[model samples]
Target: MKPVIRLATAFSILATGCAFGAEQHVVCPARLEPDAVQPNRPPSGWQLHMLRPVYLTEGGMLHGPPAESAFLVPDGGTSRKVGKQSGETQHWSFDVPHGYTKWMYCGYGGGGATLKLFRQVAEGATECTLSSQSADGVIKEVVEFVCK
Candidate 1:
C-alpha cells in the first residue's frame, strides 16, 4: 500500500509539471535582412538622426569611470560613430531617402551592451522620435529621428 501511494503521488506531480510546461509559449518578431548599403549621404528627401549617451553609475548616482564607446547602426547600413559632445551624450544624423519607409536602429557598446529601435512612422509625419535603452554596459540611451 505504501509503495502504491508513493508511485501515485509521483505520477500526479509529474503530470502537473508537464501540463504547466505545455501552456508556456514565447513569441518573437521576424528576422530582418542584412544591411547592404552604407551611403555617405542621405537619399533625397528624408533623413534619420540618432543620439547616443554613454555613462557609468555607482550606488544610484550618475558618476563613475568613463564608459566605453558606443555605436549606432541603421538597418541596411553599417555602423557609425556618434560624434562627441560636451558631456556624456553624443549625437549624429543619417539621411533617409524619399519613399523609404521601414527602419531598424541598433545600438552597440563595449562590454556587451546593446539596444534596438523598431519603428514605423506615418507618411506625412514631419518629425518623429524613438528611443531605447540597455540594462547594462556602455550604451545607456538611444534616440532616433525621422524627419521630412
Candidate 2:
C-alpha cells in the first residue's frame, strides 16, 4: 500500500511539470540612448571606452575592455541567435556582465538603434543585443563604466 501511494505521488509531481531544472529569466536594465544627456557626467570613478566596429559572426565573441570596472564582458561573451535569419544577416545576443544596470549602444553604420539589456536568471548573467540595424555591415560597442 505504501509503495502504491509513493508511485502515485511521483506521477502527480511529474504531471504537474514541477521537474527541477534551471529556468532562465530576463532582467531588464536602464537603457540609454546616444543623444541622451545624463546628468551624472563622470559617474564616480568610471570612464568611457570607445570600441571600434568589430565584425561579428553567429558564434563570434565581442570582447569588452579589461579594465577596473567593465559592465560588458572583457572576454568569453559568446554571440547567440535571437530571431529569424534574413539574407546573410543574423541577430545575435551578447551577454553583459552582472551587476551592471546601465548601458549604451551606439551604431555607426545604422541611423539609430536601441540597446536591449537581458539577464539570465539561471546563471545570473546580463546581456544585450549587439545591433538591430547594420546598414554599413558593422556594429560598434559603446561602454560607459561606473563604480558599483
TM-score of each: 0.22, 0.21
Check candidate 1 and list the clashing pairs. 42-95
Each candidate's lDDT (Cα)?
0.26, 0.26
lDDT of 1 by residue, 1-148 (tens): 0001111211111111113223111111112122211224555685533333323221000111113122333223222344432112222233446744422233223343232222223333333223233343233443333222
Q: Write model 2 residue lDDT over 1-148, tens digit each, in one string.
A: 0001111211111111112542222211122233222233445677543233222211111334212223433333233333432222122244545543332222122333212221112223233232232223332222211111
**TM match of model 1 to true structure:** 0.22
Task: Find the candidate with the highest TM-score and give its number.
Answer: 1
What candidate 2 gets wrong by more than 4 Å, as runs, is 1-31, 34-37, 41-135, 139-148
